[model samples]
Target: MQKYLPLFPLNLVVYPMEALNLHIFEPRYRTLINECLDNGTTFGIPAFINGKLPGFGTEVKVTALSKKYEDGRMDIKTEGIRVFRILDFQNPMALKPYAGGLLEMLPMPEVRPFVMVGLVERVKTLYRFIDEENTFDVNKPQPYSYQIAHKIGLTLEEEYQLLKMPTEAERQGYLIQNLERIINTLQEIERTKERISMNGHFKNLDPLNF
Candidate 1:
């Protein structure tokens, strides 16, 4: 079925089962939120890569909302409900910051449990590395898709490819491939570090007295 949705173009791709928190300060998006709350409508979070919104996005349900200021600013939490292909966009006028769109929901595959678990584990490994290197907290509840997607550091383009995949298995395969690449890169870094340490030890050796 086809329907129109309020569109929120963002720099990140949101996957189904992922939760996103957004600060709503722009007037256009504020209006969009109000409309959704009033009418029980879903919104499209089209991925904006390199400053352009992609043709496909996910439909999001507003799960929570709180007023942040007297000037209409809000703090909101949303979860992805389904994927959507944008058919058309109503461009923003001079005063509005958001766009509206016509969209159609894409079909989703019934993902097998094992596949999901594999993807989740791959993501966990990646996050562990990130936490160790960057001091990022590791105890937060992981979002099913974010773990897989964030681990490989997928570019916006690569993320779009995953979103366009027709089956859950295909998406998992793509993630696995990326994860393998990440693992290889980490191994290479470790090897280089070890070689550097050995070189330092050789330099520290006592000078030969001839």
Candidate 2:
């Protein structure tokens, strides 16, 4: 079903169930947030790629107004609720300062057992490589790929690509491949560092038998 969503174009990609804390100082966005707060509505945060509104964006609902200033600028916490594909955008929606567009709500599938398990292992391995004592864990109940997408070293474009994938299995596969590549790269980097460090050290060398 297609419905109008308030558009808040951002440089980053927000995944479902991800919490985003935003400081609303801009006049237009301030009004937008205020309206959403008053009306109990949601907004779309479309990833701004190369100065353009991209294909997919996450619909986020404000969870809390953490802080309200005397000047009307406020700090808000929002959680991504769902994914939406933009059909068309209006620069300024009717009389509103912010933009709004018709969006087709997309369905997200549940994480497949096999791919999700591998993805989680790959993520844990990535964390171990980055931090010797790894303690990163996705939010529980049902751990999915979005929980770790930002935690893993995915570029904004890559995250957007992940969002474009309709099914959780596809997302999991994408993340697993990405994490594997990253883990391999880090391993190679560590090996290079070890090789470089060994350059100045005197190693006990054994003569090769001819």
Top lDDT model: 2
> Candidate 1 lDDT, tens digit per residue, 1-210?
788777889888888767789999888889989888888888889988887776888999898885567999999889887788888888772345678788888875343223456665666677676664433222334333433565468877898888777666677788888887887787788899888888745365687899
Off by over 4 Å in 2: 108-115, 132-143, 206-210
Pairs of residues at least 3 apart in sequence or in different chains that clash in candidate 1: none
- Give the alpha carbon lDDT tens digit for every residue of 1-210 in model 2: 788988999999988778899999999999999999999999999999988887789899999999999999999999988889999999899989999999999874353233456776887788778775555454452237777777788888898999898777788889888988999999999999989999978889999999
lDDT of 2: 0.85
What TM-score would candidate 1 get against the native?
Answer: 0.80
What's the TM-score of every candidate structure? 0.80, 0.91
Off by over 4 Å in 1: 92-98, 109-113, 116-147, 202-210
